[model samples]
Target: MKKSIDYSIEHKKWLNKRRNKKISVTICQFAILIIFIALWEIAGSLGWINTFITSTPSRVLASIYNLYESGVLFYHIGITLLETILGFLIATILGTFIAIILWWSETLRKILDPYIVVLNSLPKIALGPLIIIWIGAGMQSIIAICVLILIIITIISMLNNFLECDKEKILLMRSMGANKFQILFKLILPSAIPGFISVLKINVGMSWVGTIIGEYLVSSAGLGYLIVYGSQVFKLDLVMASTILLCVLASIMYLLVSLLEKIVLKHR
Candidate 1:
């Protein structure tokens, strides 16, 4: 009875510590944001800084409200979000499959390893003209750009994870007559879940980058288009609003990946 009570007290203390830490971190983040915005607003209002270049929070809000009233705000957001989701899912799935294949065949891995490194090192923007020609200037081209940017990175990261997996465990499974498929499913994938989650976190920002760059190159709509158009017209407020929205969407996507990581960790 005493030991049970002691265990309960200890657990409660740990929980309290975790809760306090989380609250402090959240408060600090919001505090920093609020302080920065307050200073920016003051600077703009006092004529201490050029609002024409930097824009102020009020102007940014007004711009967002204007976009909202124009009925194209959601439309643009939806297009970019759709492209981001599609590209992220396709790249993750395709990358994982390719990584598994490489893990399975040493000869194939050796043959393709150098090529993969080279592709990863090459500037993706250099392929923009070719992409425009091949995919032909639309959402298709945008998504293709995103996939091209993400796939090589994913494959390289995942292959490294698979290679770093516990070799002794793999040997044990092999000794127990486990086939390649079984070993992959039971051991390799489970071990690589954390790495996959890490890559997902990174790819959230990457997807947005790809989509925006594509939109800059060619798009009738999207936050990226808004940003480009805003800059051309010297509408700094509109550019800032589009940028803030992009940051929010990217944060949400990253949070979803974090939630998935927590769930996976719990399950394991």
Candidate 2:
């Protein structure tokens, strides 16, 4: 009938609009990158910006090529990626457990909420040295830093999300003779899916920050180490190249998490 035809038209419009928006966003991102790079290269070539300190794109590429030729490129990349992934996964798991614990106990939640806020606000870099001293350097120290940065934040964030779930629904479940564990598993966790995915997105960035900071403190290898060494030796090109590579790697990681989010959204 007419109503069905109208509904079909509206659906088509929605689909087309969504498709256009996505295409525009992607195009904008690429355009911005290309424009910025072109500007940077022009400025460097024109000596409007000091290429020695700013480091031109050509120099960065040459440095990367050198690293690739030396066979140290993948080694450092792999180390940093491994550390970042390990920290991200472990922090997510630990944070989930802590969030659940906080949600389960009113007394504990009251006691710990302020502490979690304080810990999250504290600059993690200030503790990097202490972490290195305690963990005695290496990948363990890097991971510990990541966990420190991510876990409390995750717990605080997700616990708030858990608290925001529909109270009426919880009450109905309670009336139906649902125990705490049953309610948690069936309703609370399911409701918090978006929050958890958000946490994953956040953790992706935090993982890199934590790993790089940790490497700055104690790593003999990895991108952070390369950056530190490059600066010490006045090799600005290498520093810039390492930083650009970090950006690329982090973007790839974020894209993977975004893909996961899409899958989760579609399934839901």
Candidate 3:
């Protein structure tokens, strides 16, 4: 009973230490952001950098406020956010399904291996015009572009992960009269959970890239459109505000994914 109590106390102490470390890291992150912004505002005020081009933090805040007053801020944000979320979901689900199919078919995998490599190496931007032409310049085209950019990478990453499952354990399962599907369900997929999460993390970034690129090509209303318009009109403040908002949105999405990872790992 004494040993049990001692172990429990030690475990609680370790948890507290880890919690404190996380708090310190978070504080440092916010401190760096605050310092950077302070320096940036100071430099712009003192004329160390071209405020017209670089745009001061104050100017960005004012521009965002103007956008809010104009009532178009959320409209633009909603369009881009919707497109990004849709593209992200479609790409992740389709890519994962395709990866599973590829893993199940060795003959198909061998045949498509070269093609997959070529596609991965190809600059997806080059296909942007074609995608627009084929899909007709709208949300569909944007989502298609996002999926095209992400699906190949997802397939390759997930397929490799599935292949990397412990061969001896697989053999053991097979020796025990487990079928391919059984082995896959019982061993392979579960083992590849970490890899799937990693793929999801990567796809988060890729999804944003693809969506932005698509919007760059043909967008009437979005943060991308705002950026393009601001640059054309030399509204650097607007550009900076949009860019900052984009960063904030992406960071929020990433944090949500990290939270999901924590929950999954804890359960596992």
Name the regions of candidate 3 deviating beyond 4 angstroms.
1-28
Deviating ranges (above 4 Å) for candidate 2: 1-29
lDDT of each: 0.92, 0.91, 0.90
lDDT of 2: 0.91
Weakest 10 consecutive residues, lDDT, candidate 3? 1-10
lDDT string, candidate 2, 133-162, tens digits? 887988899989988888888888888989
For every candidate structure, what is the RMSD over all alpha carbons to the true structure, in angstroms?
A: 3.2, 3.8, 3.6
Q: For residues 1-268, what per-residue lDDT tens digits would candidate 1 score against the true structure? A: 3454656777878877989999999999999999999999999999999999999999999999998998888998999999889888899899999999999999999999789989999988779779999879999988988888999999999999999998899999999999999999999999999899999988888988888988899888889999999999999999999999999999999899999999988866
Tens digits of lDDT, candidate 3, 90-144: 8888888888899999999999999999999998888999988987988888888
Name the weakest run of 10 consecutive residues (lDDT summed) in model 1. 1-10
TM-score of 1: 0.90
Candidate structures ordered by lDDT, highest first? 1, 2, 3
Judge candidate 2 at residue 239 and give its lDDT. Answer: 99
